[model samples]
Target: MDNLRLNLGCGGTHHPDWVNIDFAPRQPGVLGYDLGREIPFPDDTFATVYHSHLLEHLPKRAALPFLRECFRVLRPGGVLRLAVPDLEGIARAYLTAVDAVARGEADADARHAWMVVEMVDQLARHVSGGEMLAYWRQKPLPAQDFVLARLGAEARLAIASAGSAPLPPDPAAASALEIGTFRRSGECHLWMYDRFSLLRLLQEAGFVAAEPVAASFSAIPDFGRFGLDVEPDGNTRKPDSLFMEARKPDAPAVSGPRVVQVCMQHTGGAGSAAARLQQGLSAIGVPSFLYVSSSAGHIPGVAVIPAASGQTLLREDDGRTLTHSQWPAFVQANRATLARHTHRPPGLELFSESETAARLSDIPAMELAQIINLHWIGGTADICRDTAFLKGRPIVWTLHDMHPFTGGCHYAGSCRAFEQHCGNCPQLGSTDANDLSRAQWVRKMTAYRELDITLVCPSRWLAGEARKSRLFRKKPVHVIPNGVPTDVFRPLQRAPIRNHLGIGPDDFVMLFGADALTNRRKGFAELRAALERLRADNAVSGILLLTFGSNTGPDPASLPCRSLNLGRLSTPEELALAYNAADCLLAPSLEDNLPNVVLEAMACGLPVAGFATGGVPDMVEDGRPGRLAPTGDIEALARCIAALRDLSPQDRALSRLHCRETVLTRFSLPAQARAYADLYRQLLEARR
Candidate 1:
């Protein structure tokens, strides 16, 4: 009896015994067209459908649709078998080798395992929870004996020399080679992850029940005895390679509320979000913790589990700390850090002096309410070894910048190296700048793929960039602009501010600052040129150019005007006065992420004139309260300055009122807080 079995995405490797199919019809015995375009077959056409090594290559936009197609074509009680590389298996193999290498028993298999670990680590850089495993799939088929043998010359020389140990594996080496590094049965495999993340992705993809099809029967007796059950399938006659059986139920499953823990390096952006979220949960009474690195002191309300408090204190210096847990994740994260750091100690110790970090908890399938990830894993290659941290959590990443996405640069202004995968960073003067380190952005991206996480970008520009990133492409992304406390920056009547700043009524002040005068990205050069053009205009008079920053000499010596260097004013009120006293504010930045000063300037009723770069447009209204020059155009900037000089007192006053109103309506703290509240409620309800 033909049970109506099928093979999907068969590029030329169709099983002769089954109803074979291919997206490309040119192949022989092609049964259908593109899996993404449409499912050509009828509903319940096959009782069992199988896919091998084809899932990861599909762009995220098409993955879910393909899954639905597969489901549509299956019988009610039919099985859908998906055979992909097991990230958990590879991660386990890599970790075992890492453990052995640490113990000083680095054999050929151990060395090969370490190299794979390095590759996984490199891919995990810059991302949070499950990103690293998205485009790449991990499989723990037998290592290529031929490749393992090739390590002999490189492996033997290092082993023979006692004083000269082998150079550690290059984490970014995979990025240097094309995708197909080691092909197994015609499939090109890229990365591997742990069990937790893989399971999370399956569940998130609408799979009702995802059961791991064990390959334990083929495992060595020693490995098989290590708490893994060996089961044999009579029909397939082969060990299922990390396959899973998932179904879409008629109705969704209900999950309970959970406790989420967020650990980060510091108390800024990421940690602050965690803190705010905890406060939100506290309002409704959900358990949450925001943990930060401490030099010595602990935050009052936050539960401070000191690194010194952990069972194993790995490294302790330079604002870094790693501790062990009752389980493996914390240990792996720390052990990797210790090994990497100890092998190459720097001028300063990297760990914090006050506390020890904790390890991953032993619990499996944690009903975590949410995950907040903001730790900067540095440019070392050990973060991949610590995938257990996200085992049972639904992650939420607040990407402040592209640092974790692009090999550790706070700003990836012109570098697209991260687009392919980072290594040999040109910024680092390294040949493999494009490589993402195990502890760098690539690894973070890889790890982000495996978690059921929602990604949050603080600025629209950042959010857009995150969409282009390989790690964040699959996740639900939201953009929530940063907010400011408007009451703090409220406008003071101009007369008193002018009096306090000792400015006469007749003084026409042109204000600019919050940037080094010599920096190119700030458009200081254009400011100087515009000032010269303003000074030369016969209609303008008594112009006092008030600048706040380093009084680097003007870029253009031709500009003739009285210049004041307020030089980094400390007080906000003082800044407010400067804004109020000025006839206009000038900003000419090349790139910005919702700069606070622009909003502050508007809130203080100062007219702004600048380039339309980044989030500056969200703040400046072209010809209303202020003028925005064409991006990078100095001539247009000069015209805006002249226009401001011509504005009547009543018109200027109206512009100021409009500017203030824009902030109150769109960018105030209350509005921002409300948006977040709505988002949180919506997300929570969806899960329910």
Candidate 2:
């Protein structure tokens, strides 16, 4: 076997033993030529190439070339170990937690984790004065870190002090369940992936032997500690994480052009949309370069470029700064950029070379893929313009909120100002909001003019807003609503499911789906106030408030309302059952593009009640499938719930039928997948 063990794109975290290659000299591994050019290794030089969370950031055009190069460089029978976040698994994890919470069987740790996350976010916001960008970028202040450390340490101590669960006599069966249970806690996950898409990308990239392997790690200390069976000498660590291993059988290594995927925003809400999208694409068919900022952690299919030593500044084409050692990589990257440019518009041809290279140095340019750009947060419009990553691609931007258009506010708060170049900002209480809005509008217009991108609005309301915006007025805009698979979110008819969960059949369950609690936008506080009012009312007797997504909230169990944090779901089926069990899904979001939970709940045949703002009007027709309250009307919300409780059986049945049909007809997972696939194919054809 060849002795070469390659750590592809290893950064500060690279193992001391491996031969590492990275663009940043500051990275713990070896500094090498830019990854954009052909790799320096000889044909069949290495026996193994290990890449973890490194591929999703590359431009789509360079993906094929990078894979071809990987194959050429690998010896026959050589193994390439690749790790990316598993999309399907994450989706399933999302569903399972929601299901568990609905059934009222939430574990303690799961609940605590949610609380910790909320607390941390709250502290972060308090310190940063509520600026989304500043809040996200702000590292924990000293006091905040001290508090976080104390909290984390306390939690760790408690967990360590808690005795493990006693294993069942049949260890095998119980082990499976325990493992399954641990796997279902996906609150920590924000993205999803799977083997089908991953394998396709590997195969397309020239790998002949590509297969997925089961891998996991135990968060629990030991099976023996939990009174479970242990092999005499077997490793005790639980293994649940997943990865792909691919190999090339033939081809001589060639130093070809290189490509890099740069991830701009890594932490917090700033680029969460981009992160989630990249996570989705990791498993999808494409092999590209990933270059992420130092602050960001591991993402499957991405390569974290280390910062080079101050000594090695290499001035490249378009005046972009890079390390001397990264020159070859830059050349390769430039070539890959050119290959992608072949599919772009004519006027864009003028500055393709400089435009492509300029991005790697800055944050905005890193995660640019050929067909899509996961533009993050509100302020990225400038980065979008300067980097020109949108030049040839169909940029599918998922606005976490409307901040980009509402003069730098995440929620427009009933402001029509955004419709016509946003002036007289309602949120800012200033007329100059229009001036700021027009500047952004001009920036967006400039971007729209250059790229063959599509403005993807998760909600119909957002899509309508886009139409009103001067920037997207002439662009191709589509409202592809988010979906949760009905299979995972179906009604649970099993008696034990209810009985084991300890939820009373007669209990009036008032439910809410959660995200960031500090984000007044999602309306958790309003939900809290409304629930309190219902408690004060005699009509609210036997009411149970259920919230998921955000773990931190008023104690559901203490209020005699069961709380469960299923964390993030790994499958859709798990979510369906939760939806089915709910009496009502609360979506009192002050402002939303579109809430997926509403659609998921309706699909599961449950009635929804929430504020009738954003794209929500597009989903609920007021008591047809679900009820919509006036935006921020706590009393109206309480009244609506009381009314829903009093509805006749026949009316409830009709409502359920309507809800199911609406989702099936318009928002089924299959329908969305097919639509996306069709769009992909169309883009391909247009490129040709």
Candidate 3:
């Protein structure tokens, strides 16, 4: 926390407690800066920004933009207090002086004379110090106390200096250039402001709750400590100033950098991870909005993109969208690309090259987002098709898989084609170098070339793979593991929960979960083979498998052991229960990014027995937290599972402690949010 307060054009009101800034820079420790230039600070860096008697120095045309600059630097809900010479107060004082003069009060003419000079001299003055300086030097000053009361400490000091300093450079002898230079030297007020007009000005600059306050009144804590407007003796420093404060609103702007995350849905691994990241950001004082394909329930700051009901015309110049009546034809037309792959192999990973109908601009929050976060936006090709909507916004795209870099495939598997140009893709079953995969790779890479996207991978394996690809080889890459809610996923009373789930206290239960068990990438086939081997070995007994997720895949009952299918554990509580009831999580994914199941289970104090693929090595190594074997090796996988089952009571508990500690220190959502907050600031600090 470098001082979270900013003082613009501090002049003589410099404070050690504030980040004092002045155009003149005569004061020590004050940053010499001009209001017209962009402030060399990240967005929402300060909690409060203050400037005294500085606004009137700016030309009327530049005033609103200058206020907007104040808004940009102040955090949301932060205070922006400014002091300017009040025109209304001057006029009322002038009228009161007139009434006093009419009543023939002593020094009434003196009071009126000072008022006229105050109101007109600042605007019409040409020479430095002007007529007001001459009045200060008057031998028997007209209304001397009234002038002190009106002008405060600055005038008293100016008056004291007038007697000691010798005047030079007669105005009559000055050249045209000398006079021009004097006018721009900030000796005169370029504009005036009243409370009423200032309120409107603040509102136009995107600030709310604008109102006038006393010199001693402010939302800033210990504002008087700075002694900018009031001295310790309780006398005003600049009594003619009117103080006002306005709040920087919580809009698309950042107090913590408003984040807009784009995800396809809010379920499954990618969607759930995206939603959790949003919650993480919110928990860390960053306001985040989620743009999903479709939202189910009402969640604050979560918005849905309109579902595509119409088809896009294939013809470039056609400019026609299909109607509901054309659903049959639309479906047929969409199948045209995949129709060529009629001989495509089955039992493999899912391949999608389809371009989504909804564009990134379709999300209404796009125009307002200060920082755009892209996550698992598969099928939403329009997000990258023409990234003109994302212009001027710092973008962070989280790599859920290889989808962001590869051609039409989430995982390139053994194909190194993405390292060059994706074509003749094994996943897409393409033979031609100029196939659909290459065309899509070209399309996506061309769009990416125009964007300054920073890629974030949850797994080091994914990041390394992303670097190998031509699409992201030049992009800045970061490894940020998917965060788990430690509070929700912490270890629970195991024996009681195990009894409730009909598992014996002595049973060796292993948990398994995924969107689908039949998905080849999940390595369910290998897990099943390994489980059969474990059942045959008398060394491992009391085998009980607790599985959750869609029932569409192969039945868990076919595991050659007792099994329970907790079909679709939709809530964190359900997932936590599954983690609690198990001795360890069985993750058999042959190819994947950092799986959310592994992170969640580990957070719940459950070790993992899985293949050493993707980011698994990052989490576990030879029972450090869990046991891992070479990927896709059934015998090695079975050995890993057996190693977990044979652990002594004390060893098992120690392993659980390791799992919990690993998640608490590395994978907690708060830590994830803080990392992202810092990264966002870094991006904004070096904004393109």
| CA lDDT of each prediction against the hidden true structure | 0.54, 0.53, 0.79
The reply for model 2, stretches above 4 Å from the true place, is 1-370, 375-382, 420-449, 493-501, 516-519, 524-537, 555-581, 630-636, 647-661, 683-688
Taking the tens digit of each residue's C-alpha lDDT, what string does model 3 give over 1-688? 5337888888777877777766656656665434443343445668889998888877798799788878876877889999999999999999999999999999999999999999998887778777787787778887999999999988888888886656534678888888876766777788999999999999999999999999988888889888888899988788998899999887554377767787866667887898889889988788677766544443444544432223221211222221112223434554676667866666665566636666666432245467889897654436565578765568899989887787788877777888899888776567888988888899888888888799889999999999888989998999988898888999999888988888998999988887777678888889888988977886446888888886653564576777887788767888898899999899899888989889888888899999999988887756689999899899999998898998999999999999999999989899888988899889988964
- Taking the tens digit of each residue's C-alpha lDDT, what string does model 1 give over 516-596? 554556777788778767767764477777777554634333456766666666555667777777888888877665666
RMSD of 1: 22.4
- By lDDT, the best candidate is 3
Report the C-alpha lDDT of model 2 over 47-97, residue by residue, as the tens digit.
Answer: 667665445434446556666667755667677776654556544554654
Against the hidden true structure, what lDDT does model 3 obtain? 0.79
RMSD of each: 22.4, 22.2, 19.9
Better of 2 and 3 by lDDT: 3
Sliding window of 10 residues with minimal summed lDDT for model 1:
347-356
Order of the predicted models by TM-score, top scorer first: 3, 2, 1
